[model samples]
Target: MSTAAQDHPAAPSPGPRAALAVMAVLAELSFVGASMLAWAPLILLQAIFLGPTVAAVVGVAFVLGTWWVVQPPAPPAPVLLRREQAPALFAALDALRERLDAPPLHGVALVDELNAAARLSGGFLSLVGGRRTLLLGVPLLRLLGPQEALAVIAHELGHFSRHHGRLGHWIYIVRAKWDVYLDSDPAHDSGIDRLRRWIASAFLPRFIRLSMQRSRACEFEADALAARACDATSLVQSLARLELADALMRDGLRTRLHELQAASIRPPAAFWDLVADSLRDEPAARQAATLEAGSRRPARRNDSHPPLADRAGALGEPVAPPSWTDAPCAGESLLGPLWRGTFDGANARWAEQIAPAWRLRHLHLAALRAGPDPADTAIDPLQHTLQRLQADDEIAASEQSLAALRQHAQSQPDDAPAQYALGLALLARERPEGIEQVRVAIRLDRRFAVAGYGAILSQLELHGSEGELSEFTRRRALAAEKLESLDTGLWQHLLKEELAAPPPWARALLLEAIAEDRALDACWVLRTERSNDAGQRFTLNIFVARVCHDLMAADEVDEDLLAARYGSYLRTLFPHNELARVMLRFDTEVFHPPLLERFARLPGCEIRRPTRPINVDVVRIDSL
Candidate 1:
């Protein structure tokens, strides 16, 4: 059978070690075979064809083979923890499980840093064995409140309840053993002999990593469980806050590295590289310094997770995070003014296109700073920073920004930009009066870009029935056609309005237009939002874009499309997805790597595998 494990390249260090081990066993077997063969006429005849040097060569190869087997074994290092100090943690998890009617937890232990993981083995209890303890990091325990911590535990429970842990672990073990038993055979002596031996040993861990990357559904289910165990509000807030902090920390690290690179007394490049390598090698340092893949970026912000804003909206809760700009300052900066000036220039570029009312808002802040007192200046930075934070998708921070804007706008009630900003905040919350508020703002200033854009998008979102969808489609097509002929500034301004749209269909159409103009990056961003998997509409948008634009497809599409396209020949090569029935109705081609894999497994899918990572093709279909 075709297997992914058989195809993977091995880890350099471990592969060589396994290769050596197999060589040792093979060398001993070879010696016995040679001894036996020396008495055989066939082997003796072959030996006679070679010079006396052949014996020396064979003996040298056997000696080298023995050395390979003597190499050290590379097992995963386990982090140990004590029980006595972490009793309260277990008590919390126990309480949570009881409330959720989940099975009793086996044990809880403290890890050194900020992380937690659950291991499940086959038994009456999901968690068992010395290795099965849920390792909670001390920093994380302190970082999250009770409800948030409960949510984390619930996520682990999600793993258990869904049988992900059991199924995944079994797959891991089987794949690992399969590699060791079957792939790393010492018999192959072709040009790819070294590469094959490496792949034979490393197939499992890499596969496990890939599986983990695709575990978003499990993560979301766990988040749902956490919401049930505690509350959605707390979990959303906790995740948002933790992700914000993680982002700032990573930014700090990047800033420090950047500074070092710019310094006059910078260390030799080789020395710095060596230091980085040394840090990576040290277990303790690596544990403390290295961020998990999760902590590296906000989950929803990355390609792997659904869009952060979309996920937050789906949960129907506000995710309030402390803005980095509004964060408390700790140290003096020698180049503070330079950074401030840089920021001013950046804001100025946007200021030119921002509505006049927005310009007035900035002018007002600048005027406040111009007052005699330095305290006024101190407040000005916070005011401007708060306004920036308000523009971002933070509800609580936006409210605080709105208050500042309202205070200024009270003296200038006709300020359309401030009113538009306020409208955005209300619309973000899906407040009852949000539409009226946008209308009020637009009445005062019809040229207000955000207000106009938000109004249209909100209308599309609320009234996508009867004739709205048709009107929207007509308007979008006409707009796309005209964008090329419009002035650069006008086109850019309209495009910004399109980008600001909150509705998925409108955004999809906007991205499609941009992609038609070869704006690949914008297409990628819009395509990322199709991870929701709501219905046929979402699929149609994504599927058409996959053909006409470049973007990554979701797991369901990747897994299902192959069989639906070519399942006739390879009846066995079908992915068992729940959505297969619905997905099969759509016209599909094995255009992407994932889709290609699925299609290749099919007996008769016609598309050939692409040399590049991304592939694109659109198949026409009359129905969903």
Candidate 2:
């Protein structure tokens, strides 16, 4: 019914399908090999003249091993919306499918991001007739008006119409298999496991790169379909608005979470509505400016879809003005009269999922607020010493505070808080006893999460100064593991809480721990600390930059995406700060001409190539 439908070409070359077929064959062969390994042990037992008892034992072991190795992993359960549950929505989807001349969807679901996608399930059958599911992000639905929402749906439907879903499905399966192989415990990995890893490492990157290229092309084709199905203006506007809406939603959620935590109240039943209200209130001009600023960054090399601005540009001029019409709110339009109730139900479900994490944070805060134990005579004085050490870092003052804290701790051997205070003093003095004292405190009061933070800082300070790369890397990994073992949501809540009402040095320690874990979103929240002190602001910029760099290096997040998303905003805030300029370098390649120029312009800055390439695994300790 549209130009895109009329002009749409047949599916591309069979290269991707052939590749998927080969991979399927390899997977089958691996299963066969596993079966052979399992049967070989039983077969040998029969031929070797072993006793019936030994044969029986070997048979049992082989069967168990085979079952363990060959068992198919449970498929992730999707949050599905059945036709019966939303008859109106299903009918709308059916009409959209008819317009696109596409196969009927097998399922529809909602997710939480500001995006939509089509996915296929059920292994090799996915290449042809597997269940085709459409996942629409609830945020995206809320962000768009009815026409814009339809355009987004049409974009997703375009993928299915063009048969682009199969390659992605197969690639996802192969990559997931590789992930399982790579994540296997080293102690359990035999030669076969090593071989799997090797094969995955060799082929997975190249295959994924090719797949991404195809995905990018698929996005363009999908955009064309959307343009033909809906008016070009609505599609273009939706693309730009989607990016703005995503940013607003994320920032608004973070701001609201902080407010809720400060008020010591759980999120209300109308949480999603609150978030939506915040998004609506965001100034139109500000959103436009943000979109414009974001357009300055280079496009990400590995992103599966083309950048939003590029997509909008490709759509060209609108054929006609949008035919505005009175419509219900997006939620109501999608979910009918039950929209509000469904929204509340989803919010409640999410709350239940996160309650344990919030409970832990609340318990942590309650502990911190409790007064010093009366049994620990030294606690009050030691806390005073800790405050003095934090307030001023002058060597003489620090030494005096350290001596006072140590003396107080010695007077009350059973005081865990005093021991913890002593640990802080020792660390400020760069003494090893600080680490031991903190460990002692942790042993004394097993619930002391702050002591765990202190222990990590002490280890980082000690190992980071050793200058032995291997040891530093090992210690950093161990520290990261320790931090990771803690509940991230709890740590995030604690970090946000402390940052809101900082306790001098405690905030710095929390920031370090957050950066070490590459909690980019938390770093973004903390980076807003508007200190009048230039030095503190500079330090904050460096810390945020380092966290961004670490995320890009360790998590394989695209550097340009990080730059456009966060770096541009930081540059605007800290326009003249040298550290801000230095931080922006993370988004660019090493020895880029612009970065070199920035270094040259800075008075004391120098960029030297390392004698050997530095490993990203080594934790960089920046002085706060």
Candidate 3:
């Protein structure tokens, strides 16, 4: 719908290469014009006596023409997602294909937010790249339910199944990449090229804006397709939730903006002229000033998602109360009967009390027993393989896998392995929700060593220490100690988990204290590179490895140096550990909390209170 598109009946589909060719020709023309201009003074000198007025008019024309051609097009909607990380998510989309009764999408991916959009990465091969990832935002995953989550998965599938993915990708490339070519390059010259470049630079943005309007229509089409693949109600509900979230976010942001305006210490600027003056200044200084202003601001009210009211209305669906009964899920294709066995009482208890891995290992065995039948087989190894990615601390990838697992596990609540695996993921976050989830895992299987250990660890935070803990605390500590003896892996795993907790501040303090204890237990543990006694070395090695995890969690040590030290230290402590021989190991990167706010929610943690509250009024009165 751009003016150019409307005006030129046969405008070439915007493609990066096509734009680049146009830009090249424009550049060549500019170069030629400049060269001609360089000789303009000499050419005019031949007629200087008689043509002063004509030369002045020609000079003005050249300046105006130069200004017209060199303008840049709008930078494409700022690329929010990196292109490289798309492949793995794409793989998940493929794994989901056969499992869905009718595939709505051929691929999946991470985008900027919790919102899902149906766009093609490519045709027939739409499932091939990162572009196909059913992009989910981190915050979005935090809020969505199982049924709504499946609907989104189905919705994205709807795009691919309907061939929307191919067309979407084609348009995306044309709008995004083709526009890039139109403005850049240093060679080629043609009149058509110059005109095209000028048109793209000066007018294509408005044109693309209109195209996006058209794309919005396409969005509706994709939504309808998603509804057809899944339940329309589910898609409608999901969209309503998303719209509400967005509205709430905007309202909160507006409130913050108002507060900042009122709180400013400087005299308010004069209206329009002040705005113009500030706009002319350096962006770096402006950004720095804005950040400084932000630091002095108080917290604003919490916002919810856009009111689902409007979004639901858009779907033309009658508003109905939320129904939690008998939600359809995609579990059978992912985890099979092991998913069912996990929810069993005994297994749930073990999942909660012991390492979630205990249940996971069992579930793996169950899958083997079920044979290659539909009940046992998984449609997507790529989706399931997201476990490693999750373990690696990729939140988006992890959430997708966990979402799929949760969907499948619904059918097999008795699957101790599935419950434990789910619990492990939940506990991994160290949030209240995470604690509840791991708690469920333990309830299913009392002997689950991992869940037991987690519960014990959770309890220690809640009640540990001589005078502070209640009776419950004391018992939980004892239970945790009991589980601690299962294997050296438990302690190592616990330390690893704590290190990965959102903030390492408290965990670091605890680890430092533990290191002190280690030093007291054996001066050689810290001093010697390796130990001679196998039992002593085994204990020391486990502690040291945990220490490494803590330091890494705190981001206190150089990862490369720590890795080298870990290798060298382990050899000294355990010349041969069957567990040590395992190839699976954590990556070398230091894990830090993605946001500072997560620190406030750490479990079994307390922030120091001020000895006395400061009274601002009293202080001001005293100053007077």
| Highest-scoring model, TM-score | 2
Model 3, residue 145: what's the lDDT?
Answer: 52
* Residue 340 lDDT in candidate 1: 39
TM per prediction: 0.30, 0.53, 0.28
Q: How much lDDT does candidate 3 score? A: 0.39
lDDT tens digits, residue span 377-454, model 2: 434444544434333322233456556767778887887766776775566544566667876776775434333454
Candidate 3 regions off by >4 Å? 1-113, 117-131, 177-197, 201-210, 250-314, 318-624
Residue 426, model 1: Cα distance from true site in angstroms: 38
**What order do candidates take by TM-score, descending?**
2, 1, 3
What clash pairs does model 1 have?
Answer: 20-68, 20-69, 570-603
Alpha-carbon deviation at 494 in model 1, angstroms:
67
Instruction: List candidate 2 stretches off by more than 4 Å.
Output: 1-10, 16-87, 110-115, 123-125, 179-188, 249-252, 289-303, 317-327, 359-624
Between prediction 2 and prediction 3, the one with superior TM-score is 2
Model 2 lDDT-worst window of ten: 573-582
TM-score of 1: 0.30
- What are the per-residue Cα lDDT tens digits for candidate 3 across 1-624? 112211211222456334443543454445446435554775487458668776777766765665444433332232333334434333445554654434443333333344655543423223244343345543343335555665677656655554334544444444553354343441354554565566566755554544454444444544555554455577665564454344333232333322323343222222212222222232544333433332333221111112233334445564433332323222322223432332233233422322222223223323323332344232334323333323322223246766765764565587554555555555543334554555555576544533345453543342234232233344444444443333444323433333222122222222332232211111111211222222222222232221223434564444454444433333322212201211112222221223112323444222221122223222122110
**All candidates: CA RMSD in angstroms?**
25.2, 20.5, 27.7
**What is the TM-score of candidate 3?**
0.28
The global C-alpha lDDT for each of the candidates, from Candidate 1 onward, is 0.39, 0.54, 0.39
